[model samples]
Target: MIKLTEINKIYRTNEIETVALENVNLEVEKGEFLSIMGPSGCGKSTLLNIIGLLDAPTSGIIEIGGTRTDGMKDKQLAAFRNKKLGFVFQSFHLINSLNVLDNVELPLLYRKVSAKERRHLAEEVLAKVGLSHRMRHMPTQLSGGQCQRVAIARAIIGNPEIILADEPTGNLDSKMGAEVMELLHQLNKEDGRTIVMVTHNEEQAKQTSRTVRFFDGRQVE
Candidate 1:
């Protein structure tokens, strides 16, 4: 459902130029679960950001669900991203002041969904993540695993077609990391959501349907 052709990303400073991605071409089919694994400075996160439309590529094209995103305006890209993508990060990225339910409902709020509908959707996702009872808890009140579960719920609350996770288990213990990975697998296998996860763990990458290795901004076989 996602296609990248000759994707190139460059970072320029007054004295230096850094190439984050070099003519990267890849395709992820609908309902596929793909893991990107690499060492530090491999551009995995940069590629993920490009796929999520959080950053623009210096050249090449990206098509999401068949629409070309390369030439879209910022507002158009933002709207498209909101409607088509969900993100889960290692940091959880939850607002400290917001309760679990409110954090989960935040995406729907941007979509202008009605309050009743957003609450219902958010609550349903929270229940799926076994967080219904903790809906009113703040981020500080939850353990790392619980907080990650809340983040996962928030990511899926909008029913976005693709989930982009960057080092999702980086901050958790092995057990908690496994739990998070299991949840992501369940979403991919049962819910039929496409997932592109960037991680440094070999065992974690092995659990995914397919794994792509990267080195110094280039994909390795």
Candidate 2:
């Protein structure tokens, strides 16, 4: 469902250049749960950002669900990203001022969805994530695991084809992390949502269907 060819990403300054990804080639089939494992500074998160359309590669081609995204304009990319991709970050990036339901509804609001429809869809997604009862709770009132579940609810509210999770379990305890991973696994297996997760935990990586390791900005066997 996703393909990357000879992808290269570089950060530059007037005097120095650093490569974050080098000639990276990858393919993630539909409904596959894949883990990217790497030590610090190995470009795993960079790769995830590129795949999620949050950032562009310095050079390469990226195709997602049969659409080529390499040359899409900013507006087009933003629209495509909203329609095709979802993201979960290491930190539960929820708006503290918004309750669980409103946070989950934020994406739909940006799409110009009407209030009634947005509330309906947001509640459905919250129910799917088992957070229906926590809808009125603020982020600070939830446990780490519950907060992460709320984040997942936000991610999937749009019904995107792919979900990109960067260190999704990084902030949780082992049990909580496992719970989050299980949720992601269920999404992949039962709902057919393609997931590409970046993780440093070997055991967590093993829980996925496939694992890709990275070293020094390149995929390693």
Candidate 3:
């Protein structure tokens, strides 16, 4: 479902150059839940970003669901990403000013979806994530786990084919983290959504369909 060939990401300045990923080639099958495990400074998040079309590699080819993305223009990329990808960050990127339901409805605003349809879809995903009761709550009013659940609802509200989650449970306690992991597994198993998650938790990585480890910007396992 996703493929990266000899991907290389580098940050260049007039005096210095840093490599975030080097000659990394990886693939994830459709409906597979893959975990990326690595130490800090490794290229896990960088790889996830490239796969999600949020960032471009300095060199390499990326293909998602059989479409090559190497030469897509900015407009084309935006359209494609909006339709095919969903993202959940370590820090829930909710709009603080918007209530839970409104935050979950943000992604649909990019498409031509009507307000009525958007609200309905948002409500459905929130129910799926067990956040239906928190729809009217503010981010400040919810626990860390609730915030992340809302983020997941927001990510899936559009029904994207792939979900890119970066340290999804990093900020929560064990119980809450477990709850979130169970929800992610349900999404993958029941909904058949392909998930690629970056995580430092070994136990969490163990539960995924496959785990790939990275070190010093390269795939080590």
Candidate 4:
């Protein structure tokens, strides 16, 4: 479902250049739950951002769900992301003033859905993530786990084809992390959504369909 060829991401300052991903090549097939395991500064998150179209690689080709994204214009990229990609970050990234329902419905606002339809879809996904009761509460009103669940609700509300999670469990306790992982597993195994996760936890990586390790910006395994 996703393919990257000779991907390289480099950052430049006035007099220095740093490479984040060097000659990185990878793929994730449809219906696969892939975990990226890497130490700090290994380009795992960089790779994920490129795949999700949140960032462009310095050079390389990226094809996601059969669409080439290397040269997509900004407007086209936004539309593509709205239709196909969902993101879950370690931080909840919710708008504190928006409340749960509005936060979840934010993604749909970019589309042409009516207000009623947007609310209905948001409610359904919030319920799916076990947050229906907290829909009216603000982000500050929820616990970390609840906030992440709300974030998950927001991510999936658009019915995205691919979910990219970066350290999804990094900030939660083991029990809460397990809960999130179980939810993600259901999305992958039951809903048949493709998942590519960047995680530092070995056990968590082991639970995925496959694990690919990275170090020094290179895939070592």
Which wins on TM-score, candidate 2 or candidate 4? 4
lDDT of 1 by residue, 1-221 (tens): 99999889999999899998998888899998888878888798899999999999999899999999977899999999999999999999999999999999998877878999999998899999888899999999998999999999999988999999999999999999998999999899889999999899988889765555654586534
Q: Which tens-of-lDDT digit does each residue in 1-221 have in candidate 4?
A: 99998999998998899899999888889988888888888888888999999999999999999889977899999999989999999998999989899999999998999999999999899989998889899999888889999999999999998999999999999989988998998889889999999888989778755545654586635
For each candidate, give its TM-score against the true structure: 0.96, 0.96, 0.96, 0.96
> How much is 9 displaced in model 2, in angstroms?
0.6
Candidate 3 wrongly placed segments (more than 4 Å): 210-216
Residue 176, model 1: lDDT of 90
Which is the winner by lDDT between candidate 3 and candidate 4?
Answer: 3
Instruction: Please count the clashing residue pairs in each candidate, in the order shown.
Output: 0, 0, 0, 0
- Candidate 3 TM-score versus the reference: 0.96
Who is ahead in TM-score, 2 or 3?
A: 3
- For model 2, residues 1-221, the per-residue Cα lDDT tens digits are 99999999998989899899999999889988888888898898899999998989999999999999977899999999999888999999999999999999998877878999999998998888888899999999999999999999999999998999999999999999988998898888889999999888888888664555544577644
Q: What is the lDDT of residue 139 in candidate 4?
A: 95
For all predictions, the C-alpha RMSD in Å is: 1.2, 1.3, 1.2, 1.2
Q: Which portions of model 2 miss their true places by more than 4 Å?
A: 210-216
Q: Give the TM-score of candidate 1.
A: 0.96
